[model samples]
Target chain A: MTAETLLTWARGSAFDWAIGIFVFGMVLRLIEVLSLGKKPDLAEGRGSGVKGGLKTIVTRSIPRASVFAREPVRITNGYVFHVGFLLVLLFYGPHIEFIENLTGLSWPALPGGIIAGLGMITMASLVLALIFRLRNPVLRHISTVNDYLAWAVTLLPVLTGYLAYSHAVLPYTAMLALHILSIELLLVVAPFTKLTHMFSFALSRWYQGYQAGYRGIES
Target chain B: MSGPSVEKGINFIREQIDAPVASFFSSCVHCGMCAEACLFYTQTGDPRYTPIYKVEPMRRLWENEFTLWGRIKSTLGIAKKVTEEDFAQWEELVYDGCSLCGRCSLVCPVGNDISGMIRKIREGFSAAGYAPEGLIGATTRAITIGSPMGVRLPALKAQIGHVEKETGIEIPLDRAGAEYMVLLSSMEIMNFPEYLQAIARIMRQAGRTWTISSKAFEATNSGIQIGASDLARELVQRVVDAAEELGVQTVISPECGHAYTAIRWEGPNLIGRPFKFKVRHILEVLDEFREQGLIKTRGKEQARLTFHDPCQLVRKGGVVEQPRHLLDLVAENFVEMTDHGAMNWCCGGGGGVSANERADELRLKAFRQKKSQLDEIGVETLVTACANCRITLEEGLEEYEMDIPVVGLTETLAEHLVEEDQEGQG
Candidate 1:
């Protein structure tokens, strides 16, 4: 097929396929995980476990004072990427337009300048994270091949998106097509990989909190 | 392949792949913060002892058995199966290196209960017959004899005789209508009989009817330390039956750490039903006495002291504030460790680490975390609630040749108990 034809299919059919796979795979993964239900804690609870569970989903994101003291770098850089990614993904105008087309939803976008600045910062934070992982002995020891893969795949779309929007890397159509293709790669790989953590992290925290909260330990 | 075949290990771990385990395996962000929280890792600077890494076998098993990519890797001959060698290496990591102290759990940004997962991983490890010899022998003795340390009825009776003679109070035995059934660790019977005498005196002064049962006097569950739930249930069942048979209103777990957890937290689940009575750590009961004005101390210790929170008693057992409350009662110059209460460092010999004598050197090494905490506070007397913790602390202090004396909270409180009725007639 011609590049024009491929780009059209990539934006149209490929986008539909990516969304379908992303949603269906994520829902199925959740079913597989959630269906393996635990036995009800037959042990008596000392406090409200549900309250602790809900509390952890929020509290876990904010590091404990002691933990932050020890891990200020990871926590600080971690939030940089996370918060930056959220800003770029949800508040960028074109991204919002695409979401509107896909899900029949629209919301006001932040100014282009701010989104671009945050996108660059997020991309740089990911690089620093990668370097931190490689340089730190403990992190290097614990990290798997998938850890590097997760980082690489996550960084690609942000870089390509910024390049495409800036019209600096290649022709607008081609760069945008590559950006979409990288995103499709992310969507396809996500459910099968650790990116499933995006959804699973909250549920896992809830379970963990529920488990410890039974003994009245703060999660 | 040289050791016992791990097919049963595989089966046990396979069954443990629940939602939390699945999510923990999937959602670990590979940040390595858990290493900072782990005593073994921080003290030894060994990355292998990373809390999450200790359970790598289970994680790998989860992947190969449960995940699509893992299945593909297995088909492609890329994934490593959990071998005997894996068990052999991890035996050190799981048993010696970890205290199941829950610090890693508390520190995980993702909220993974790494220690709880380690406890689950041990079910597989022990079932595969790869557990340490010390724990195995203890578990065996726990099943055959009444105590893990092989303390039998005669030994307990002898200790009871000593306490009764020393205190001039008739220690009750198997009274049918006592309000509480007191359980003792073999350590308390063999090494720290002061804990027993303290209870005897305090119960007498509080005017509460309590007794020790010949059948279920042992509280520390070697089965729990050995990671055999079946055997742990049997051991816990003994205490339950003894308490219920005595028709007691409560079962007071003596100054032992895991003993409290094994009974208070894990008791109902082990027996698959609620007990006929409540369970409380002896400190909790004493703190109750303090709160109720039943405990009146005559004097306070002049020596500088700090309380070391036993991992199981405070972190796992929720007996956090009781020891502090009791310390305020008798300690004149009491101070706090840098990390006291729920976040306190382990005495390096919990989760059966002390029982597994093979872990002696590593246990002493992990003691540095506690030692550093003590050094910063520079207290002369270290008080703790758990008998296991007290012994471990004493050993650690002695290893560093530090002059600190490790005392049980019960014994410490008993020393200052207003010298209640010297003639023993309540």
Candidate 2:
């Protein structure tokens, strides 16, 4: 298909529904974040001076950085899954082209094959993680329904995208439509599920870092 | 691949654990975020010391021997067998690497109680006669003798006589029908005899009618530390029976962490009835005395002090503010450490960590976390409310080459007791 045909498809009913779902999901996520009781003041007694508070945030955060540094292999797998997922979501050829046409802003895109390949890898990693969670009783016991939901939503988009690319028994447009729907579902669920941990993890790490640094101790 | 062996292993595992404890053991996610919370992991940079890794063996057993997926793995020969080597490796990892401080439990996103799991594993080890020799010796002494210190009746009476002679105060022994019964840990009678003297002075200042039983006066319970519920109960029952015989309104626990938990949480459950008399930690008793203006403290000016919250006392007992309030009353220059109150770092000697010789390296490793916190405050002395914490901090300071002195809150208070205030008004 020509670039114009792809652009026209993106601006059609499928994209509009996806956008609506994305907006609604974001609102739901905001509600979830607000509901997690007040952010605890972890720096209550360490020190109170301006410099001390800043130091605490910085020092406490070092533990989190050290965590990633200490276990590079596991962390690298996590990084690839996250970064690759983001690249496909934001910089895929059709998505970027559509965004450029609509917003009058343009960015370079990864080739179709590269985006699809990255998508496949991200999906595979996520599947491996889910399998690990299930196979390990310790993890299985702690996991919530939402954790499984997150894996399913995360995997659905990639699976549908691959199916659309392969043009299986379903029409290519239908497969693309399902893929877009699944992606929208994930975007909406992100803020509500433990997936919102993405935001809280950074905040918690920063708070711990600041407290440790303020106290002039290695976190 | 065989199913019969897997079934046998599953039955063996089930026979070893109670239901509630087993369920809790099966709930870790292995995210290793708990590693960041572990001081041993931080100090030694050892992955095995990470709280998550430390519990992996227990996790594996819970999976392969108890769960369906684990059973499948066992049948396929994919699950590793638990060898004596595995036990030996885990002995060091669980005993020394973890203080059972509950810090990891506090930070767990899923609220997995890693400390509780460690305690349960310790229980398993203890049952299997695999507990550290020192800890087993201590527990054995505590069970056979009246106290873990093994101070017999003659020595205890001599210590009491010495206290009476020094203070010119009557140290009542086995005085039944008293209003309060004071239980002292063996550490106080053996190591810091002044603590017993201070207790007498406080009771006299308040004009309280109290007695100390020669038989059941020891309050230090090793069972709580070793995760031996039966022994912990027996220890607490001794105190309860003595309190009943004395008809006391309250039983005051000495400056010990596990001892307080033994009497407070496990005391009632073990005795199969709720205690009528209130159980109070020494810090709480002092806080009350200070509030009522019963005990006046002086000459704490040179002491720049900070309070280390004992894990059992603060986190488990909810006795945070009382100790700090007492410290504020006594010390002129009271500074709070970064992790004070319920969030305080463990002194690396709790949960029987002090008695476990194999835990030495892990203990020192964990001490670095607390050492760094103390260094940040730069205090002259670290005043804690628990006797175990006092010992742990003293050892930790020496191991870490820190200059800070570790003293109990009551010990510091005893040093500041006003001379005129000691004269009997009652």
Candidate 3:
């Protein structure tokens, strides 16, 4: 089949599947939150009341930003991995074009060279993180079979996407098909795993702020 | 560092502690989120002071000897041997940096119990004679003389006598058939004689028959603070035996934090049977007295005061509201500090930190947090129910040069106690 014809069919199916996965993922997340065990009571008294909480969230959270700024190599590697993953999901030219065609919204695309470079970097970083998780005793003890599975499932798309871009052993359409399938699997599983921490972290932080406030302390 | 016997003892106890508290010590993921919850880390901005760091020695042990990566690291010479330096470093990290405040456990998603792990590590150090000289000295005194402050039987009797002389009310001592037995720490007898006086006065005014046991008068359980369960049990058993001997209906723990937990909570368990007598903290008794109208305060409205909730008595014992209820009745201008009740910052002397000479820096650092909390409220006097908290906060205020007077809650109440003649007029 011609590249244009194959692309047209992939776009239509992928759009429907992505939307279905997104809606299902959100419902599962809501269920998980509702099913959580009873949260401890954390009410306290604070001097600034509401104003102090906001100031603390903004000011205190900044200097502590270095926590998220991993080591230099880790940061560089993480940037590449995250940027690549984001591009494939939201910024690849064809993906953007397909989304615009389907949903009537469009976004600027990254240059093809940058996109390809990011894909390689993402693959490298994922390998490094995986190695560390497996080799570090402390990390290994906390991890489960599901944790390894989740990492593999999340990384498959990036690896396959890069293969499709590089047009290695697998044909472009074949690699793209696997990439799309893995991305769909990840979306469905995201809310159920430790990955849900992304959303829960903000909620936990807010609860902490409220607790500090109740104690009559600046958050 | 050169003592082989000490080294062997340390190793043996470390092995035992590792076996006992393995679950808590091995569970940390090192996310460093707990750093923000620690007053030591918050004040010092030292990563070494973080609660996670306090548990790192145990974590390293678990990783090196108990896990695959540790084995590999050992083979590669990347993991260092546990040495005297490691124990010394861990001593400072655990004793100085941790107050066992349980805040980190609250924030931890995994429920790692960093505080519990640190306490167990302190137990290992204590067994090895590696504990700071001050804490070891206090524990030795407590074990030998039956009180951390080393006040003997005569001194305790003298203090009780002085209370009687001042109040013109006979303070009960060694009574054969008292219904309630009150236990006071030596700190109260030596420093805050008025607390003993107040308790005596309150017991007399309430008309409830109570006696102070000359044998187990000291309620300050240094064993609990130093992480020595056997020593703690020995201290608690004295009270248990006293209650049995006197045939008391209830045992009332004086205004000491660890004493309340030790006697009220662990006393029964350590005795290997449920305590037949009831266990009540002094604050709870005061609240009961107020509710029953057994004791009335006349000039309570004149004092401008704020309360400092000792972590053990308030947080661990769940006796927050009773003290506050009593404080509110006593102080007309009572203001709550920024941190009070369960969330209150440590007085900086808890968990044997006050007695640890090496913990001075971290103790002062922890106190700074409380100092700031007090400054925000602008209260001139801080009333705390715990004798340890009273001493710690007083020391803390002096260390910070804050000029805030720390008084016992009962002492504050006693200041406003209505005399028999005055009560009829009111």
Candidate 4:
């Protein structure tokens, strides 16, 4: 099909298929995880697990003082990509428009140039992360196909969006279509891959904080 | 592909897949940040020491059995199944390479409890009989002889007699209706009789009624170390039975890390009920005595010293501040390590690594992390609340030819305790 036709098909049918898979898959994954059920801690708690869980849900975004000193590059790069990716994804005009269309939610968008700058920064950060993963012996040893695949799919949308905006890699319609398709691929595979950490990270962090807090520790 | 023990191991791992374990495995993004937190990795620079990778057998079992994609992959025979060989490979990683220090759990960006998962993974290894020979022997002795180190009641009685003669104080045993029941570790009973003397002198000065239960005198739980809940429960039950029989209001855990955790933190849960008497670490009890103005001290040591926070006491048992407060009473020139308190590095022999003779070289190698911390401060002495940490630090210091002497925090405070005549003169 022509790029125009591809853009239309991507925007119409492919978007629905991707969103359906994303929603259903994430729900199933959550059920698979949460349904396992945590046993009640019979031990007396010295601190509040709920309070600790809430505190960690936000606090864990920042690295611990001791850990940050040892792995500054890894920690800083992690913040750069995550913060830049979320800012670009949530506040960029077109993406916000897409979300508004789907969920009837609206917010002020960041200026186009700022979002574009963030997109580039995020893409660079992701590339550096991949290089770090490939270079670090521990990362290289522990990483599986899942790790690299998660990195690639995460990087694709940012790269494609930049290319589409710049009209550099392909015709405008084709590049924009590819950008949308890249996101669709990410959503489709997210719940099945290590990318599932997007949701499970909060749960895992809360559990860790709760257990630690129950023991009266600030984790 | 499988043996009965391997089958049992897989089944145990399957049973261990609770929500936290499932969430931890699911949320791991393979960043390997936990390696930086683990001393085994940081000291040895071995990629295999990465904390998450240490639980590969459990992770594989979780993947193949739990998730939808994993189930599909398993049906297609594409997923890697947990094998007998995997257990053999991971036994060392789970038992020796890790101290269950909880630093990795604290440092995981995703908040995965990597150390907790390692603890759970040990259940499978032990079930499969892939545990270290030393740990197996300890477990057997703990179950049959009432002590992991095979220290029996007669030996404890002998040590009590020595302490009584040395301290000129009566040592009470099996005294019902005492306000406190104290437990001793075999390490303390055998290697450090001074800890008992400190307890006796401190108890005499505090004017508190305490007794050592002859029935459950051993505090160290090898069952907990070997990851056998049934055996740990039996051991804890003995303590509970003794404490209740004595009608003590509190049971003081000796200056041992794992014992405090096993009895205080994991005990109630292991025995399926709340403890009748509260469990306090010896440091905590001494701190309480200090707070009550019951135990008065006179002078401080002139030597520069630092406190070594035991992993189980600080991180697991929440006795972090007590040791510092108790140390403040006796240490005039106390210095803090770079990562002191809850975030402190382990002594490299916690979580039963000291008991496993096979891990001696690795344990010593991991001690480099502690050695560097000490070198940075250049302390003349190291005071710790855990008896096991005291011996481990002594060994590590001797191995490095470092001149720093290691002492228990309790004994240090006891040395400086105000005598009755000195108190009257003051």
Candidate 5:
């Protein structure tokens, strides 16, 4: 197909299919998890699980003191890429306009130059994360093919978006189509891979905090 | 196939895959942050000892049985299956390498309860008959002899006889309607008689009525360590039956960390109901006594000292502040360890590691984490609330030829208790 046809397909029918699968898969994934309900703690709780759960939902974003000390590079890299990814996704002018069309909400967008810089940083961080994963003995040992695939799907959007914006290598229409397609790939694979952590991290953090809090210890 | 086999193990894993565990497995990003928090990984520098990786069997089972991708993989015959070999290989990792210290759980950025999952994974290991012989032996003794160390009631009575003669106080036996019923670990009954003496002295001074059931005195649950909840439940029921039979207001778990967790935290769930009587750690009881002015202390230790917070007591039992409060009343120069309280490094002998002879070398190696913590803050004495921690610290210290003495926090408080001239019988 021509670049124009690819761009139209990427932004229209392909995007529609990707969003549908993403939403349905996420809901099904959530059901699979929630349906396996945990037993109520019969032991007398020393503190409130709900309070701890809510607190941990916020607190777990920050690395623990010992872990940060031991693995500062990985933790710092994680923060940079995660924040950069979210900022670029939410604050880019075109992304906001796209979101506004769907959600009927508009927000202030970061400047083009700043978003470009963040996109570059995020892409670099993603590459560094892969290198770190490959080099670190523990990470290398624990990571599976799913981890690598998740990393690729996450990295592609940033890379393609940056390339499309700078009009580098590929034609503008093809590059933009690639950017949208990369995101669609991410959405399709997310619910079935470790990328599911994007949604389940909240549940995981809450449970950990609640368990700790029940014992009157902070996580 | 019906007995402890691979199929049974897989079924147990399926049973254990509740929402929290499911969430935990799903959220793991393989960042390996858990390794930094685990003493086994940090001390041994073994990538295999990474906390999340140790639960590989459970994670695999969850993925294959619970996920859509897993279903597709299974259909394609590409899914990894939990095998007898997997169980055999992982037996050491789950039982020997891990102390169930919960450090990894706390440090996980995604909040995966790595230690909790390890605990669950042990169920599969134990069910598949892949549990170490040492743990199997302990569980058998705990079920058959009412103590993992094979300490019978007669042995406890012998220790009670010694304590009674030494303190000139009657040790209440099977007394009904007592305010508190105290349970003892075999470690305390066999190795640390002074812990019993301290309890007697403290209880007498506090003027609280207490009893040690000839029926169920042992508190430590080998089933918990072995990761068999059914076996754990049987052990817990002994304490429950005795406490309820005596109608004690509270059952005091002795200075053993896992015993406190088994009885105070996991006991109710294991037995399928809330305990009729309250369960309090000995440290919590002593702290309560201190707060109520039921006991008084006139002196503090002269030696520079530090408190080793037992992992189960602080991390799982929530008895953190109570020990610190009790320690404050006895130690003049109490220096906190670098990562004290809930974040304290385990003594590396908990979660049945001390019982499993196969893990001795690795356990000792893991002790370096605790050793370095102590080495960083030089102390003349180490005080801990758990009897198991006391023995483990002593062994680790002896292995290192570090002459610093380890003492029980309860005994330390007992030593400083103001002499009450009118000592009444229990």
Candidate 6:
């Protein structure tokens, strides 16, 4: 199929299928996870486990003191990439339009040049993070195939989004379609893959904090 | 049975991945901070010793069993299947390499509870019988001989008799309605009888009624160390039944780290019920006495002293501040290690590493991390609450040819106990 026809198909039925699968899978997987239910803590809690859990869900996002001292490069890049990804994903002009269309929610967008710059930086940090993972023997040893795959799938949308907007690579139409398609790929695989950390991170942090918190310790 | 099969091991792993496990697997950001937090990885630089990697087989099993895509990949033979060889190879990493110190759990950016997960995964390893032979022997003895060290009631009675005779203090046994039912680790009984002596002196001063249940004087749970909940529960039940029968208001876990964790924290969950009595570590009870001015030491140690926090006691048991508080009462020159308390380094022998004979070399190697920490502090004496850690610390110190003398915190306190007037003491 010509790029135009393929782009049309990917944006139409493929997007629909991807979104459907993504939503269903996410909800189902979340239900499966959240529903496993904890055994009652019969031991008298020294602290508020719920509060400790809530505290950790927030505190854990910031690296622990020892870790922060040991791993500056990795943690700094992580913060940058996450901030950039959230900004460009939620605040780009056409992205806002898409969100408005999807849910009638509209927001102001950053300027085109700024968004483009942020995307480039975000994508660069991701690439750098990938290289860091590959270069460190400890990281390389512990990493799974899914770790790299998740990183790549995550990077594509920003890269493609930047290209589509800047018209620096393929035709705008093709690049835009590819960006959307990449996002769909991420969405579809996310619930089933390590990307599930996005949702599970808070819950796990809470559970860990609660466990630690019951003993009056912040994890 | 030759002991340990892949199928049974995998089944245990399958049963262990509850919602928290699911959430932990899902939320892992692959940040590798857990590696830095793990002493095994930091000491050996082996990625397999990374805390999360220690639980990899179970994570893979969770994926294959629970996730749709993982199932598809498994059927297509693209995913690696866990095998007997995997468990055999991993036996060292799980038991000898990792101490289940909970440092990884504390530093996990996503709050994964890496050590707690390792503890759960141990259920599978134990089920498969892939655990170290030394731990198996200890667990067997713990159930069959009433103590992992094979000390029976006779040995305990003998030790108590010595303590009573030494101080002319009455050491009560099976005293119904006593305020405290004290428990002892096999290590304390065999290696550190001074602990018994300290407790006798401290309890008399505190004016608290305490007794040792000859029926359940053993405190350390071999099943906890080996990751057998059923066995741990059986072990915990002995103490529970003894304490309940005697109707003690509190049960005291002696100065052994995992004993404190097993009896105080994990006991309720393992036995599927909260104790009718509260569980307090020796340090906690002593600290309380200090606060009440019941424990008055005549003098403090003149030399530099530092505490070695047992991983289970500080990190898992949350008995962090009480140790420092108790130490403050007796150590005029007490110094904190660089990473003391909740984030303290393991003694390289906790979580049953000391029990497993095969782990001795690895345990010594891992002790270098603590050695380095202690060297930096340059303390004259090392004081710790756990008897198991004390023995391990002494062994490690001797192996390194370091001049540091390891002392039990309780005994240290006992040495400084004030000789009160010969009034009606108790």
Highest DockQ scorer: 5
lDDT tens digits by residue: candidate 5, A118-171: 999999899999999999999999999999999999999999999998988789
The DockQ scores of all candidates, in the order shown, are: 0.68, 0.06, 0.05, 0.82, 0.85, 0.71
lDDT of 1 by residue, B184-211 (tens): 9999899989988888888877889999
Backbone clash total for model 3 is 6
Per-model TM against the reference: 0.97, 0.68, 0.68, 0.98, 0.98, 0.96
Docking quality class, candidate 3 = incorrect
Model 2, stretches more than 4 Å misplaced?
A1-219, B1-27, B64-66, B71-84, B298-300, B418-426
For A108-136, candidate 6 gives per-residue lDDT tens digits of 99998899999999999999999989988
Query: Lowest summed lDDT over 10 consecutive residues: which window, candidate 6 chain A?
Result: A210-219
All-Cα superposition RMSD per candidate: 1.7, 10.7, 10.6, 1.7, 1.4, 2.0
Give the Å error, residue A55, model 3.
Answer: 30
Sorted into a CAPRI-style docking class, model 6 comes out as medium
Position B20, candidate 1: lDDT: 83
The best candidate by lDDT is 5
**Candidate 1 - CAPRI tier?**
medium
Candidate 6, which segments miss by more than 4 Å at Cα? A1-10, B1-4, B75-79, B422-426
Q: Write the per-residue lDDT of candidate 4 for residues A1-219, one digit (tens) a residue.
A: 999999999999999999999999988888888899987777767898988887888888877788889889888999899999999999999989999988999999999999999999999899899999999999999989998889989999999999998888889999999999999999998999999899999999899888877778767
lDDT of 2: 0.68
Tens digit of lDDT per residue, candidate 3, span A1-219?
665555555556764676686666555544433333322322212243345335434443232222333234533554556566777668778779867987899989887777778777777778987776676443454555557777887788787777788888577876776666677667666654545544444343334344344434323
Candidate 4 Cα errors over 4 Å, as ranges: B421-426
Query: What TM-score does candidate 2 reach?
Result: 0.68
Query: What lDDT does candidate 2 reach at residue B91?
Result: 72
Which is superior by lDDT, 1 or 2?
Answer: 1
RMSD of 5: 1.4
Model 1 chain B: lowest-lDDT 10 consecutive positions: B417-426
